[model samples]
Target: MFTTVKELTEQSVKSGLPLSEIMIRSEMDTTQKSRDEIYHRMEKNLEVMEKAVDRGIHEQVRSHSGLTGGDARRLQTYLKSGRSLSGDTLLQAVSMAMATNEVNAAMGIICATPTAGSAGVVPGTLFGLRKRMQPTHDQMVRFLFTAGAFGFIVANNASIAGAAGGCQAEVGSATGMAAAATVELAGGSPEQSADAMAIALGNMLGLVCDPVAGLVEVPCVKRNAIGASTAIVAADIALAGIKSKIPCDEVIDAMYQVGRLMPAALRETAMGGLADTRTGRELKQRIFGGRAQNPAVEEK
Candidate 1:
């Protein structure tokens, strides 16, 4: 019944239980499902995430609009070149994040961690860490539970829908959840996990949901990549003992308020931001033909 980051972290610390355990216990109480059932379901989700990441990186997955495809493979090839400016972990996270979202765009099976648009971040960070940490299968599944814990707080206290709270709610919350889970997986304290979430989410405040052509291609895929990188960095900062001056719950509240102030055009309407750019509009007309020749409907 934890509805805020403060409550979630405090319980984790007091009970001497990992954040993931607390979430599993909470799920048991609420759903009355046996522990094995809940765990097995999450494990299935992990399997789906693994397959999506593998498929996207190994294949040239393209959306129907032809806007985003093969970028994840492209990034992976670059990683193999040994000339990347960023470290392998960061680049791998970015590539994997792009991979998951690209799969979603291509209509491939994907586990939507919070939503399909932001699905990449959680598995991205986890698989990225897998490259360096070598977590066991159980640890990998527990990583998801930890991420779900933070996501639960965000979804209950704020929003996870793009139309309701913009891209900040989608990608932003996903990034925070990934960061917190990364912290726990790295042996950081529950308090540090909360700090990681605050830092990650605060970094993405007010990000708009202006998907071109009202589709989850284009910026959405790239945004998940960036969110994954942000999550990794945020987790590192928290593990280094840095704290967010603004608490995790307050950051979430700020996100909600900012979303409320955002105009409808910026809230997934495809009538503003990159969606309204000349190139964006041109692509829209090309994709939808005469139907998109008309101007976007104004919000009354």
Candidate 2:
């Protein structure tokens, strides 16, 4: 168990192994499972993610509340038109990210890379990379392992639950994980992967988790799209030899501290931030028939 990015990178350097292999070995040791077993397990998860991404892109998946749907298809259609100002890869990532979350919102199956709310970023970047990088199947699986390694560190040292640490913990951690994994998949060094994680996470620090109507549809789906875009950019920056002055572990710690200081209303309580706005309250009332006020605090 590498507890921090520094330890993870140091071990990877000392052993001349990719971060994915280290995580695989660690999982084997911890679970007393064979390497093939663990790899196959993660492969199953990859399949689920692939299916969700495909379904979302091809179908108009709408949530029960009808808060979010069809946007992924809209983006894909826009991509097909080739009139986008943003680059194809970035827009593709954003589309896929929204697709996965849209599927999740519609109660479709999705493999949570860290959490279901932030599941899209990893596979979003992975498929986006497929366009140009053309990584093999095994390499794709390793990409997920690399992501899981960083996610493990965040879940253990900081938090991966939005209820505990806000959107910064959920989507922010997933973005960092995806950024590091993206660097590794692109053949960057372990140090470069660490830099990507730090840079990506720093960009998302202190993000609130104020889902409108106590649902994960409104901002959550779009946040995943932005997170994917950020992860790709961060990975490119790291691959370009740009390093974050704040180390990866320290950035994660800072995320933890910020989450700790964040008000409860911003930490998945759905009583503040966008969730507390006049329009947000109106949406809540419409959704729940005017009984959606925070249970612990009566609305004046």
- Models 1 onward score TM values of 0.96, 0.96
lDDT of 1 by residue, 1-300 (tens): 688888888898999999999999999999999999999999999999999999999998998888888999999999999999988999999999999999999889999989999999999999988979899998899999999999998898899999999999999999999999999999999999999999999999999999998889969999999999999999999999999999999999999999999999999999999999999999898888765434786434
C-alpha RMSD by candidate, in order: 3.2, 3.2
What's each prediction's clash count? Answer: 0, 0
Worst 10 residues of 2 by lDDT: 290-299
Candidate 2 overall lDDT versus native: 0.94
Candidate 2 lDDT over 176-245, as tens digits, reads 9999999999999999999999999999999999999889887999999989999999999999999999
Q: How much does candidate 2 score in TM-score? A: 0.96
In angstroms, the error of model 1 at 20 is: 0.4
